[model samples]
Target chain A: MSQKAHDIFFRSNAPVTVDEDKCIAHKGCTVCVEVCPMDLLAINPLTQKAYMQFDECWYCMPCETDCPTGAVKVEIPYLLR
Target chain B: MSLDNFLNLEQEYDIVVIGGGTAGPMAAIKAKERNPNLRILLLDKANVKRSGAISMGMDGLNNAVIPGHATPEQYTREITIANDGIVNQATVYAYAKHSFTTIEQLDRWGVKFEKDGTGDYAVKKVHHMGSYVLPMPEGHDIKKVLYRQLKRAKIAITNRIVSTRLLTDASGAVCGVLGFDCRSADFHIIKAKAVILCCGAAGRLGLPASGYLMGTYENPTNAGDGYAMAYHAGAELANLECFQINPLIKDYNGPACAYVTGPLGGYTANNKGNRFIECDYWSGQMMWEFYQELQGGNGPVFLKLDHLAEETIQTIEHILHSNERPSRGQFHANRNTDYRHKMVEMHISEIGFCSGHSASGVWVNERAETSVPGLYSAGDMAAVPHNYMLGAFTYGWFAGHSAADYVAGKEFSALDKEQIAREKQRVYAPLLREHGLPPAQVEYKLRRFVNDYLQPPKVTRKMELALERFDQIEEDIAQLKAANPHELMRAMEVAVIRDCAEMAARASLFRQESRWGLYHHRVDFPERDDANWFYHCHLKKDQSGRMVSHKREVEPYLIPLDDHERNAYDKLRLKAANG
Candidate 1:
């Protein structure tokens, strides 16, 4: 059929990461997610652990600085690095 | 992400502040202080705890008007000359007069400014005529202090609502705000007696040269939202042609921070490591020299810090890395560049419209009131020339007190139901579409066109073509598809960028003479024509809703500048350099 549709997926390494061992998102603490200015961090529904859902990070580091248990780290995006 | 349950969430407030950044918090706090009984709501698209340009805090006040260091009259004169004499002296004078009080207020609130052993504000000479740059070695916790104050003031804050439109009554006065939640996609119908917009600069208007969408000098969250919101509500914006193009790190897209390093003896140098300009204060004239050197074969400029002592370099690294954009240290480390041995490379930033640095914003008077009746604006979005952080705080205070007095006996105006429905349909069309262009892709194309055609050394023909392209991008905005509320936010921001682009083209074309150096350097109109173009170029939406441009006569100078002071910026080239 001429009605074929396609989507392109671009892969990017999230500059921000959450150390799951220290992350307390499973205990209902959402400080990191709540404080991010770019709103890039979110908790995975299945794992209940915080992760970077989108690669559009400003690397502003509120997620890292505001984490209660020191679970997050912000790296310079690879493109700028 | 349907709007079914979110349709009935209507709330009322005496005053609504639309950003939680630098000025918005101050506005909210001051309004609450003016009358503690008033119901004020402070909101941001992101959490207010970490939002705006100072989300991570700033290194220092770029323009601090302290008592022992400089006088208000002197500071006002410096800004008047630096901005090439199109300033409303009354507004700048008001900020200068109240600058120290604002500093004292922030100091009392636990935000510290650097002081000498004698406990005076350690102001340094960065401007050609005066000493205004006051450092804050421990300014990293400014947001924490403001947050504490916000809590103490008992102001209500709603996070994650991206305000897309200002709701005005039949009498054409701003009465409320319309927005949606970025997470739940809840449509917000916030009715207020007065609305204050503290959205930061139009940082995302020009796509960065690195081709990265979020790579910008001003925080990427400041996508010209306030300017768009104010313009759509029929506010006059001044100096839109005076684009904000800064000398930033080559690819990092953050400030190398001339204000911080310059006071400690670091200077901007060419390939030969020769200082061309006498001062490191950011002015259009200084940028003109930098541009000349770049185009005149000494192409790449560098922040010359290698010659400084190791202790000085460490102090710079401590302040530059610890505050504002700490990831800057990592960017330098990745490139193997260190202040101890290697000079950092620098480039001109993509163009933007920010009154904080270069004086292009929604027009406001001495009281921070816009041309509209119940609308006010401050921060980078307010048109106060060379007003940096201190200006934002001062003007935010003005907007708060003035707005409090304005709504003293005022009642809430009726909300226009038709306007709310139309804006709702406009915001949600992207989410309802099955297939369309992505918001990010459309933004990239629009901003790349901005860099190509609108970056200065502007030609009349090229600017005309930019206007035509911007018209096409408006049509493209209707075809944007957002799968969720986050993408919906980006889609709305793209519309703001398009409005700013059109304003840039129209404002630049309206002013027929070159002024503000690289900011509005029209190649076709290569000289400053004070005889014909001395007046301020004001732009607004006319009665028919077309973007119209006009001229506003410059007010008579209160502190009159002599001939020598007027030409001070023109003679910035150092005499000792290669002489």
Candidate 2:
């Protein structure tokens, strides 16, 4: 076998979740994405729906509270919980 | 590719305010009010509407010196005593004198404060001596109110820009700021006559004991950006050893809010559900008692509220859930704990630098002016000692007015292109790397070292070892890779965190005496040596670009305290019943 550089991925559950049915990101609404202080949420390019892009959520609830359609849910991060 | 090929944007302003959460907004508003003709720009790494420590809004003023309740001199005396007589009384007195005016201004701006039917402010007593804590049962909309005022003042707002370094001129005066948009990675160079740093605390310096990085008592966005920027800009940072450690909810890692619960008859109790401390005011002496109780086999404290009436608990629940970390309700519900039946578990928070809670920040005078000529600082990042949100607003008001007066006839110094060029390369390196270490892993390892080595009960050998590890992390910073602009922002924050960690270690090593309870408790130098260490221990970058620590005398008090008042905080621990 030849030695070469490669990448590995770690899997974890996202604390901030968005409901696909209620998400209005396709309509150009990025309320959840914009309101996040940590900038952890982003709109999925394929689905045009908002999703948690990172695991670093403060669980501050601004995303859920400021969501236009009540599409966002912030759970306590598993490690803290 | 050359730096010019990237999106390099430049703008000019009379004054630039960074970190738009609480103080930055007030700074911009007051600067505009001072001189409406002056162009002001306010920027934040996060959206200005929701940034900084009070992004979700605060529950109440922890140190409101209102008339008929407390005098300015009295409040100053109380703070001076609480901080073990090391505070600059003039700065605290300045905040106390202007505290009511700021409160009235907030009231006029449609923010509600709890007032009795007799038309008097309902002030509650939570401190050891004076009455402060004024509640805002409806303060969740404070950011909305501030955003409205910013728009009304016509202050130019730039959101999602993470400021990396302040640009200084040949005369060593701050002339501009260098930062990049977190979403686009576009470079920004804003020329300004004066710059006000209200960038909150170095809250993310220590990792939470639960091993969660973002689970911090202060907002995770405040990753010591202002402190790092000020230090690199040649500003004196006072009392780096005096760290901010609070009694917070375990695992969840947020304030149990003794100010709120204590007023409502909820108290901090040991495992046996008995009170051990007389006061819940978050002073060093109070935290000392809390640490003693936690360590003396009376471990794992709780906020006892089961004895309170159902209606009072309801009020507590409504207030705690509706404002400032509103998710507290969700965390509690998930754990199946209620204030009516179960006592909410409490634990001491990890250490960080915050003048608002204990006093470790950029040194500024009563006028909010830093040692640097064109730079001003306020809020948690500035060393005003026990300057909570209200002090943030009041000192912000002072910084705004002072910077306005400063820039009256001054011209923007030419932007230092060399500084801009160097910062641009430093910032973009992570994104441009082919393959390397992830920023999160690096941050995790770094913060774990912080907890291991620097979480008080400070040992000299451990801190020295921590410095060696910090130096190793500095090399690790160069290997960080960012897949996107957001990741790049965090990568840069890793660099800032490294700088703060090194500074914390050096400052802790420089101070030989244990003081401020567990904040600077060095086991090797266990006693408080007033004769030898009575002066403020300040740290700054020396001429050789080395971090150097020095001593500065504590300014004489404007309001002298009697011997009894001076030793008041020393008696916070309740004597045993048998004694």
Candidate 3:
């Protein structure tokens, strides 16, 4: 998809990771997978950590907003503009 | 990525307003109306067309205009009730009384509201107030109204842009702002008399959340830009706690807009499929009341929704005159569009949404002035006394008018050349090379902690654990070095994530009695402490970047509700009492 076609606020092929320190492992953070608009993140039930779906992402704040423990983060490439 | 773009920063303007949302645009319009010759520059990190609660086309406006459905007094009552009474009474009235006027002002600005078959403006919107929530329809499409005014004002609209930071004099009062063109990444300096920080509340997770197997992203640009700018410029911040949550978002997640649940008649249902609002501590009365249900073990509660009634869907279709998901009148589109029959299963499918139902921000005086001398905040950026954001309307009006006036009244001071050079170095320092911290790793951790742990109502111990974990995660932020513009922008997201964690920690630490919204579960202090804990747990920032807690007494506006309005609230309460 054209970058302009998507909301300028989001980025595709952006790096996605989770903070291990903040993860309480309540096992309730499944909303990320369920609501992944880009299908960018996956869960490793064995390791209990999420993996990235680098090929697809719309870069919205739902998963970040929904996390109860303040866990999710988003980093998009932006310049001085 | 190029040195050429760094040369894009220009030095001056007539007016520079910080945010580009409902309040910012309104402020820009107000300033233009006052001075046509003024060079007005309105900027946001994203396009103005898609920023803020209104621009995102979340839910319809909930203006407290009519005395019948919700008198300003009654509205204030509701706000105080929701806040457990910590709202500044004068602050509530200032915004509550003006909501009616704001609605009318929006109409005067040429934005159209949904009209009834009789061609009169509709007073009651569908699915509001009670089960229907059918109260006064306070117009629709806030973005349309503001946009019309912006165009008529002939204000320079820098839609896709960035509010990089603020420019201040040695004395530490705001002089202008630093911004960049979204497409070109061109640095633009907007010199103005006063600056208003309406860059709405922080929410960007520099990283994806760890715990959530997966979920939709919440806000794309709300990485606490206002808070960071204010803090860097030495502005006092407040209410870092009291973050909001639906508790039901995971149950029936879809649509990035808030209020999506309301129109769908979505409610919280526990693992047993029983309506948990009444059963759990959370009140089933308003949709927000469901937060208590899940917090109190009513969840792991999945949301239960009846899907749009087939004919109601058709009626919406008839009104919109199109078959699009968001009807031309997009007020309730989020609710009606998703054809999911069950709410719990819906959560398993779609991403999360946004709503003004809950959230906290910096504290502001009636003039919307922050603790900082020359800085001001409005809309979601300002820490409101309560959740209704009564001041968002008035505060925006005040901030724009006041900030413009402050600029007009002041004399322009020349840049201390040495200081300017120092600031320039600061801005580019991150771009020089790569720090040990990777942007993705920092972002990933920040996202997981905030969205997964902070938003849900878990136990005190679990919450404390979340807070401690956040502290350690934030440590990695310092090591993040931006090698390029994108990296710098994402690196700046650290400020946003830090503030998010601060607010979440505060929300967990305070509010021993989780009475309302998503903060309902309590293994420690398990019951509602209306007598002792019914006030707001406010947060202010310390010099150390840690949150300082304060208790704002929740006081009621003692005015009697209008006869008819009182009767309406009484009816709702009467049902509760009888039950």
Candidate 4:
């Protein structure tokens, strides 16, 4: 009766990262989040800064190119790298 | 978190273009040019600034059909032969005849093509029998050019909306589109007199061999949305059995791009650095040779650029790394494999349905009209053989003009309330579930099953098992839970992927022949059967809403090939010197 099936978390690095100091997310700019093809980047409510919320990075770098403040950097995922 | 559904939001457009990629933008622009008074809506799941197959931009046009380099007749003959005689020649001819016009249009629009000293289109010979590859050394700005045109035309743009299904009327013609925003989960209902679906290939149908889910040749956002949407709207899909399997850079899972580097002195080589095939143009027959070499004693295949001169290698690197998939350079650098010292490892990509590289997509006539009324298609999702990016633009032009004419005196068909409600429930079920399977897990499993079974050298039993497994996965689809709208978008994509998987299997089963080389190599029927199976295999949703497969006869050729030209692709394998 006590047998439980629960979820566990695995750690991996996010391929797309945003520099908080330059993000301008709190100042109301969402260009990096808006231009991402995969919709993987979002602004964290607590931090008021953009960040990658999913591991599904295609490494097709619109977030880096389209960013207004040059805040986003895309690295090839470890597996592919 | 409770779902923030945008139920009350509705829209109406005179003509709606469902993807803002290579084709959809052109469709909207040309439709406006046809009638500037018509209200057109250009929509996408991502920002139009960065979307579709050419999101990062294309390196070159795979099929250019320029004036002095190749005529429409020659290009048509080449495509007809490459596809093994199962082509809608009228459609290919239409694309061929107008190919130069489309190139001119792009050229005038500030998009550039490679030019000779005399200002002629510098078309290179990459195909087995024709010169079609037109390099775009500065082609990375294609999306920017399209975006400029879209804005100058004053077209309305909506981003982040994933269009899921088509809304049909009482007579079963597409009248509206139903979808949700991936970021906000807001519902969209767009009413129109005509609709065009340019939503690229079903690229995410099979799992890449690397076990990394996101690494696919086509952008992962494609995910078969247009193919599934067309089928549900009663549009016929042609040659789904002839799958798209490219020879990609091994673990990176992107194109090695022989089209660009082949003319520059690079070629596909085996482990011993010997050119096994005479031509590097991507064809099912060529892929078949590639698979043979990979399975042969030269087990690992590679892109051989090590012998190229230093200047040519630098030029190749600049073009390859800057356009299409820019991260390719990073991947090569991470592995520390320089093209000067070593060959780049290559492998066959997982299969999908793409009419751009191979002929498998929603059936569209020469006018770009689908079987269903008021519906049109172009791009990788539309069946026009090796249409590539230029074909997307050309067919997009056709769909736009055709839809503009079709909707001139047309009236909007009434939307069905019941259909909307049913789709709303289906779309939001995963978001409402308390706790269950995750969309990513389900998608990973489904695609892995696709790789295990439906990937070529087709075994009859394995495909049947794939259908059964796909049916089981539908149960898992129902149980899928999403914590947020972003996840919900992926959840809906999983549903579309499942539909495409089922279609791929059923269509492969109906073909019953080993044609297109490694693409549809049915083990039981191991040879090309022209007598019984020369027709194109089409799949669609029958009147009863059941999946059905039937053979559609290939249209009579507008340009017939000579005996020697017909078998050019078949003799691609280079014979040994002694033999």
What is the TM-score (0 to 1) of candidate 3? 0.70
Better DockQ candidate (1, 4): 1
Query: What's the DockQ for every one of the candidates?
Result: 0.81, 0.80, 0.03, 0.77
lDDT on C-alpha atoms for all candidate structures: 0.91, 0.92, 0.52, 0.91
Fraction of native contacts (fnat) of each candidate: 0.78, 0.77, 0.00, 0.75
* lDDT of candidate 2 over A1-81, digit per residue (tens): 977466788999988888999999999999888889998898899999999998889999889999989999999999877
lDDT tens digits, residue span B1-579, model 1: 454545657999999999999999999999989998899999899888999999888999988888878989999999999999999999999999999899999999999899999988899888999999889888889999999999999999999999999999989999999999998888989999999999999999888878899988888999999999999999999998988989999889888989999999899998989888898888887888888877788768999999999899999999999899988998998889999899999988889999999989999999999999999999999999989888999999999998999999899999989999899889888988788888989999999999889988999999899999999999999999887888899999999999999999899999999999889999998999999999999999988999999999999999999887898888888886536
Candidate 2 Cα errors over 4 Å, as ranges: A1-4, B1-5, B577-579
List chain B TM-scores, each candidate: 0.99, 0.99, 0.77, 0.99
Per DockQ, the best of the predicted structures is 1
Model 3 lDDT, full chain set = 0.52
Q: Candidate 4 lDDT, tens digit per residue, B125-220?
A: 888878888999889999999999999999999999989999999998889999998877888989999999999999999998888888898999
Q: What is the TM-score of chain A alone in each candidate?
A: 0.93, 0.90, 0.60, 0.93
lDDT of 1: 0.91
- Candidate 3 structure quality by residue, lDDT tens digits, B226-329: 76677666664443444444332331222322233344354445555655333211111333344333345544546454455776545433422221112122
- If scored against the real structure, what TM-score would every candidate get? 0.98, 0.98, 0.70, 0.98
Model 1 C-alpha lDDT per residue in residues A1-81, reported as the tens digit of each score: 568345576789889898999999999989988988878889998989999988888888888888889999998888787
iRMS per model in Å: 1.0, 0.9, 14.6, 1.0
Note the residue pairs that clash in candidate 1.
none
